[model samples]
Every structure is written in structure tokens, then in C-alpha cells.
Target: MKHTLYKHIQEGKTTGKKSFAVLVDPDKVNEATTEQLVSLALDAKVDYFFVGGSLVISHNLDECIRQIKVSCSVPVVIFPGSHSQISRYADAILYLSLISGRNPELLIGQHVISAPTIKKSGLEVMPTGYMVIDGGAPTTVSYISNTAPLPADKADIAMCTAMAGEMLGMKLIFMDAGSGAKNPVSIAMIEKVSSHIEVPLIVGGGITNPEKAYLNCRSGADIVVVGNAIEKDASLIRELSDAIHSVPVRV
Candidate 1:
């Protein structure tokens, strides 16, 4: 693992720079669609491309990754919904743990099954702690992981969970509202969790507009992830880039 992507994230932390990542689920985006997104990402200065989904039914993950790598300069990080989502074509993998839930599979069982393969794939494994917050609806991630999200207003629960993840040595912390959520993670939750953790904070799901994306960054998120929003409106990429990068990332 060269860690180019991880290093880029670290540099952002050091310089107080915020980043934007566009999620391209292979189940959702094809090769042609991926090329188009990558082209737009290059122009928008999207810092990373997150490639994966909760239920990856498509067999074209590798092909999509290959096309994006050929078309873009941004790092492609594997946002795996499961161990089966692995691909060496990516620059890195967010090795996630569903710490907000007690599901043994997401926490370590799946990792146990996939670790050997992931080790062999050579993708930069970023140990990420994944927390799902109530997004005002039932999300695919919540359903798939068999875990309930933390209450939207329970900042204390979210913060303590993130603190536990950091103490356990996670490299990154992700606060997700689940894809196609009715709302993004609340600004209060982002502030509470990020203030306590030293790791880079990533917030995603249902951030449909630049305003929400911008607010996430301003609230202390180091990275703002937009997927369904981009899939709905590719033009939002540039605006979201401006929104997130507008505020300096502060830990």
C-alpha cells in the first residue's frame, strides 16, 4: 500500500484544508457513467472517489474502478459495504467497522473473513470507524448492516462511540446518514463527534446541496461525501467542491 490517498488526507489535516469525495457505487454507475463522473471530478477538484455500496449486486466493480482510474487524477477509495467489494484496482479501501451497532459481522466477523484477501490485494487499508446516525428514514446501510442508527439528537452517544473508536486506534471516523437519506447528519452531531476525535472526520449520505455540504465542513467535518446527490445531479460536483473547500478543515 503506497498510502497516497491516506497521505493526501493527512496533508489536508495538517494544512486545515477540507476535502470532497464523490461516491460511485458500481451497482449504480457503469463504466461510461464512471468516466463521465471522473471527468467532472477532475474539473471540480474532487479530492477522492469513493467506490462501493451497501448491496453491491453488480459484477462490474473492477471495471468501473479501472475506467475511473484511467480517466481521473483523484484517488479512488474503496468504500466497501461488505468484504466481497474488494478490488485491487482501487488506490485504497476504507476498512470499516460498524461500531455504532453490535452486529458482529460488520464489527469484526466480516473483517475476519476478508482480512486475508484484503491483505493480498495491496489496497491501502484505512481502518475506518463507521457510525450511522438516524437520517429521518430507513437507509440501505442500516437495513443491510442489521443495525439501528444512533438517534439524530443524541450527540452524546455519537461522540462517545467515536471516542471509543479513536481509543481503539481507528485511522478515520465516518458519520453516515445512509444513502438516499431524508436528511444529512445534523450539524450538532458533526461538531460533537469531530471535536473529540483526532482522526479525520467523514460525513456523508443525503447531502443533496452545496449548502448542506458546506455546513458539514464548517461544522468540523474534514471530508464531506456526496454520492446520491451527484448521481442525481452531476453539476452539483463543482458547487459542492466550492462549498466544502470554502471552509478550512479544523480538527
Candidate 2:
């Protein structure tokens, strides 16, 4: 399967319909919890499940993915924080490059060591440019990646980075306001970056409510991801889904 998720994104782009994805951090939630979330997610009609964390201290990933697949119909893609997070059962993996960071390790070093194994996993690989925008907190992704996020006000820099990612043949561009961010990526930043990139733009991190999600879509984010907020209240899944699907404004 050559990452059908990308095709779904493209179709959304062509149709001007927004997409919603739920990010599940294995280290934060358990199997039982995951199963419950699956039911909620199904009802919410989420487009995808992103599994992984900056530091995957949990061993339940394989079981978690298996359980989620059995109950959920949406594609489960691995949003790996480390190469070890790969699960063969996943529909695909985001082959990420931290384009906003200057660290060689994240830029290509890690990919070098994990390439051979990934090629054999039979998992669809989607090359993604990952950018961490200042989310008002120093989150684990920033700490672990050993890179500082671009200032939220620097729309020009974010735009250039995203454009660079597209020029380098990336299939998608992901802008994350680090987990538990007090503030989500600014709408201006989203607009600046999205307007400059042809590939799908996924905005996540600190999206606490439907209003924020709606504004993001209006700002040109093709896909909006909700994670931390949903964990606090599973019911937000349905509301978020409605917000993303009910309003399909193209910016």
C-alpha cells in the first residue's frame, strides 16, 4: 500500500474539504483507554490515528495499534518520535524531517540508520516536513529534537521552510505547536505557510477546542489534528469532527 493517506489528503485538497486526525501518545494512554477512544473516534469520524510520542516509554504500542485497528476503521499511521516506534501493523509511517531545526541527526542522521529496516517493513512511507512552531511551552519534542522552534510571529521563516520542504519533494508539511502548548499555531502563521506550499498542510498541537480547529481550517490548514485536548475530554472528538467537516472553507 503506497500510503493511501496521501491520496486522501490530495482528494481533500481538490474538494476543499478539511480533514481531522487524532494523535494518540502510547506513553500517555493504555490499551483499555485506547479501545474506548476507538469507539469515540469512530463516532467522531476521524480521518486518521497518529500514534507515537517524543519519548515512547511504553511497550503497549503494538498491542495498542492492534486493538485500535480491530475497532476503528480509519487509517492508523505512526507519528514516531523515534525509529523504535515503528509498528509493522500500521498503515503507514510519516518519514519526517525536522526542517525547522539545524540538527543533522533529525534532519537525516536518524533516517540513515532506520532506512533499511523501514524499507522492509512493508509500511507506506510518506515523506513529511515537520516544523515545531513556538507553542508557548518547551515541550518534549523540542527538548528531545534538540532544536528551538521558530518564533510564532515569524511567518516569513515558516513560509520559507515549508516551501523548501515542498521543493525537496515532500508529500506533506506538518506544523506542530509542541504538545500541551498554551497557545496553538497562530492563524497568520498557518496562512503564511499554507499559502506558500502546494502539498497538504497539517496543523496540530494546542488545538484545545472546536473553535480553534475551525479557525485553523479557515486559515488554510488542510488537516487539523487534536490530541492533548481530546485526552482531557474524549467527547471533544465528536465536536472537533463536526467542526472540521461542517466547515470546509478554503483560505
Candidate 3:
């Protein structure tokens, strides 16, 4: 693995720079919209393109990734929902383990099944500890994984889970509130978890506006991912990216 994408992330963390990733749910966007999003991203100089979703039933993953690669040089990372979500067209894969939930499948079971294939695919495998925090509603991830999210207000739990993930050798820590979250992950939660972890912290879900995206970065999120918001309004991409990049590099 070249570790190109991971190196970019690591450098950002080391330099206190913030990144903005556009989460593209293949099931939601068609070819035309994807082109539009890629064009906007190219103009915005977006940091990364996260392609996947909890329930991507449309079978558009490969083409979606191919389209992004064709349109821009930005790295495309597969945010797989399951073992079946692998694709050779992507630049990297977030090998996620659901540390926040007790589900064996998400934690290790699916990884076991996907490991060999992932290894052969040549996608830079980023071992990510994925935490699902309560987003003030029942999310598809909670239902599909059959696991409950950590309580929204429980910063202690979030912090400990992230620390455990880092200790367990996770290359990155991602805390998501799930798609279309009623409330984004609290700034307090991001602060507590990021302060304790050495790895880069990624925060996503329900971040709709530039202010919220910027706040998430200021609070310690190395990467702020936005999907549902962009699905509704692609124009928000530039503004959101600007907001995140506007955060002063931490000293």
C-alpha cells in the first residue's frame, strides 16, 4: 500500500490542518449528479471523496468511483457498509470495526471475510475504529447492524471507546451520527475523544451548514465528512470546504 491517502491525513493532523470529505452514497447519486459533484469538488479543492452508505442497494459503487477518478485527481476512499462493498476502482478502503457496538460482525466478523479480498485489491487499507453515536434518532446503521449507538451525551463512553480503538492499533478514529442525523455529534464529544487519541479523528453525519462543519474542525475533528447535506444541496460543498479549511491550524 502506498499509504498516500493516510499520509495526507497524518500530515494534516501533524500540521493542524483540517480536511473536508464529501461522502457520496452511490445509491443516491446518478452519473450526472456525480459529475456535477466532482466538478464542484475539483473547484473547491476538496480533500477526499468518501463513497459508500449503510444501505447502498443500487449497485452503483464501481461506476461511482470510476466517475470520480475520471473527473478529478482527488483520492476516492471506500467507506464500505459491508464485506461486499469492495471495489478495485477505489484508491483506499476504510477497514472499519464498529467498536461502539457489541456486534461481532461489524467488529471483526465481516473483516475476517473481507480481509483476503481487500488485501488483493491493492486499496490502501486504513484500519478505522468506527463509533456510532446516538444522533437523536434511529439510524439505518443502528438497525442494520443490530446495535445501539452510544448515548449522545456520554462523552466518557465516546472517549474511552476511541482510546481503546487507538490502543488496539486502529489507524484512524471515526465517530458518526449516521445519515440524516437529527443532531450532529456534539462538539464536546469530538473534543474529548480527539484530545485523548493520537490518531486522526473523523466526524460525520448531520453536519449541514458551514458553521457546524467549521465548529467540528475547531473542536478537534481532523476530517469533517458531509453526505446527506450534499445530496440535498451540492452547492454546499464549496462553502463547507471553505469553512473547514478556514479553521486556524492548531498550535
Model number with the top lDDT: 3
Query: Which candidate order results from sorting by TM-score in descending order?
Result: 3, 2, 1
Task: List lDDT for all candidates, in order.
Answer: 0.90, 0.90, 0.95
Model 1 per-residue lDDT tens digits across residues 52-141: 999989798899998988876678899999989999998999999999999999999999999999999999999999999999999889
lDDT of 1: 0.90
List ranges where model 2 is wrong by over 4 Å.
249-251
Candidate 3: stretches off by over 4 Å: none
- Candidate 2: tens digits of C-alpha lDDT, residues 96-186: 9999999999999999988888899889999999999999999999999999999999999999999999999899999999789999999
Put down candidate 3 lDDT per residue, 1-251, tens digits, no spaces.
Answer: 67988998999999999999999999998989999999999899899999998988998999999989988889999999999999999999999999999999999999999999999999999999999999998899999999999999999999999999999999999999999999999999999999999999999998999999999999999999999999899999999989999998867
TM-score of each: 0.97, 0.97, 0.98
TM-score of 3: 0.98
Least lDDT summed over 10 consecutive residues: which range in candidate 1?
A: 242-251
Q: List the residue pairs that clash in candidate 3.
A: none
Q: Would you list the clashing residue pairs of candidate 2?
A: none
